[model samples]
Target: MTTVALVNTASIQERRDAGGMYHHRTNFDKYHPGYFGKVGMRHCHLKRNQSFCPTANLDKLWTLVSEQTRVNAAKDKTGAAPIIDVVLSGYYKVLGKGKLPEQPVTVKAKFFSRRAEEKIKGVGGAWVLVA
Candidate 1:
C-alpha cells in the first residue's frame, strides 16, 4: 500500500501579504465616525433638565418654619392654637437625624426618611409629600 500527503505550496511572503490584506479591512476604527448616538445626546439633555433641591433635617425644618411664618402659638393664650405650616418647597429630602420639635409642625416636602415620618407622626406633626 502507498500513501501520499498534500501540503500548501504558497510562499511565506505570499502568506504574509495575504494575512496583511485580510487585516486591512477591519470593523474597528481608531477614530470612529459615528461614535456618539441618540443615547449620548439624550444624556446631555438629561443633564440640562436635571433639577436640584436643598436638603433639610428635622431640627432645621423647625427653625426654618419658625423663621418664615409669623404665626405664634404664644400669642394665643385663650383662643385656638396657631397652625405652623412648614412649606419646604425647595427642599428635596427631609432627614430624621436631628432633634424633634416640641410643637407639632406641618411639613411639606418632596421626600422623607422612614424615621422622619415616624418622628413626625410621633410628635403629632403632619407630613405631606409634595410633587
Candidate 2:
C-alpha cells in the first residue's frame, strides 16, 4: 500500500496505467505500414485497375456441352445439336487446355486464347467479347 501512497495524489486509479504498450516494436512501422505506396491523386485511391483477372478454360466448357447435348455416342443420336450459351462474367480470358470441346457452345467473355478461339470457331461455335 506504501507504493500506491506515493503517486496517488492526482488520482488513485491513474497509477495503474502502463501506457505506450506498443512503443518501439520492431515489426510495427508507423510511416510505412502494410500495403504501402502512393496510389493516385489522394494517395489513398488507385488510379489504375488493381484487381486481378480471372480465367476460364475450354476443358471446363466441355463438361457443360456433355450435359446439355446428346452425349451418348453409342446410341448414335447426333441429330440437331443444341448450341449452348455459356455466360462467364468477371473472367478476362478463356484458355484452351490442350483439349477441344466436342460440341458447339457460344462463349461470352472478355478475351479468348488463340487456341480456344480457333477451337470454338472451328466447331461452329461463337466467341462474343463482352467488353
Candidate 3:
C-alpha cells in the first residue's frame, strides 16, 4: 500500500493603502496584488485603462450602425443606402443587451456571448471573430 500526503500552502490577505484603496495579496507574489498584473498582452482598448474590461452591448452596436448609415447616406448623392460594418476590434466581449437593429449589420469582434450570437443572427446580421 502507498500513502500520499497533501499540504495546503495558498493564502490570501487583504491590504489597505494610504489612498484608501483596498488590495489583495497572495502568498506567491508579494509585489503584484490582483489578476491585473498577470495580463501581459495589450489590446487597443486596454491602452486607455489597464483595469478596463470592454463589453459591447447590442444597443450600442445598433446606435453605431445607425450613425454610420446616416453619415453614408448624407454623402450619397442618389440617396442610396450603403451597408454598415461595425468593427469592434477594441472590445473583448460582445454582450446581448438591448434591442437589435432593423437593418443587417456585419459585426467584427474578438468574442461573442451565446445570446449575442443568437441576437445577431435573429436580426439577419452576421458576426466574425477577429484575431
Candidate 4:
C-alpha cells in the first residue's frame, strides 16, 4: 500500500529544496508528525475514496466505519449500490445532487450544514451521536 504523508507547506518545500530524497527521514514535517519522535510516521492511506490517517483516534474512526457500514447496509437492502463517499480524519460526509433518505443515522462528528442534517432526518433517518 502506498501511503502519502502530508506536511506543512513550508516544511515540505524546505525538504524538497534541501534534496531530501528519502521517503522516510529523521525529520518530522510539521503538518504530519512521526510517532514518538522516533520511527513510524503517521501517513495517510488511501482506501476507496477515503483518506485515512492510521494513527488517528480509533474512537473517531469507529464512527466513520459505522456510518459507511450503515450506508452500505441501506443500499444493499434497497437494491442500490453504495456511493462513493469522502472521508477525512475519521469523518465521512457525502454531498451530492440528489436528496438522501430520512433514516436514523448515528454520526459521531459535528456536521457542517443544518440543511444536510435535516434532509437526512426527513427521510426517516435520525442523525444520532455516537459516543
lDDT of each: 0.63, 0.61, 0.63, 0.44
**Cα deviation in Å at residue 49, candidate 2?**
5.8
Model 2 ranges with Cα > 4 A deviation: 1-18, 21-43, 47-50, 64-66, 69-90
Query: TM-score, each model?
Result: 0.51, 0.51, 0.46, 0.27
Which window of ten consecutive residues has the lowest lDDT sum in model 2? 18-27
Runs off by more than 4 Å, candidate 1: 1-44, 48-53, 67-71, 74-89
Q: Candidate 1's residue-wise lDDT over 34-116, tens digit each?
A: 44345433333356425665678887765664543424643544544334334434568888987875656667777789998
Backbone clash total for model 2 is 0
Regions more than 4 Å wrong, model 3: 1-53, 65-89
Q: Write the per-residue lDDT of candidate 3 for residues 1-131, one digit (tens) a residue.
A: 99886744342222223222333334324554563445667565445555565777877775655566756655666634344344443566778888874555567776788998899888666888876
lDDT for residue 57 in candidate 2, whole number 0-100: 81
- Give residue 1's error in model 2 in angstroms: 23
- Clashes (N, CA, C under 3 Å) per candidate: 0, 0, 0, 8
lDDT of 3 at 116: 86
Give the per-residue lDDT of model 4 (tens digit) for 44-128: 7746544432222222323444576756657666644332222344454432224544334433333324655565546554444
Which scores greater on lDDT, model 3 or model 4?
A: 3
Model 1 weakest lDDT span, ten residues long: 19-28
Q: Is candidate 3 or candidate 4 better by TM-score?
A: 3
List residue ranges in candidate 4 displaced over 4 A: 1-72, 75-89, 92-98, 102-104, 129-131
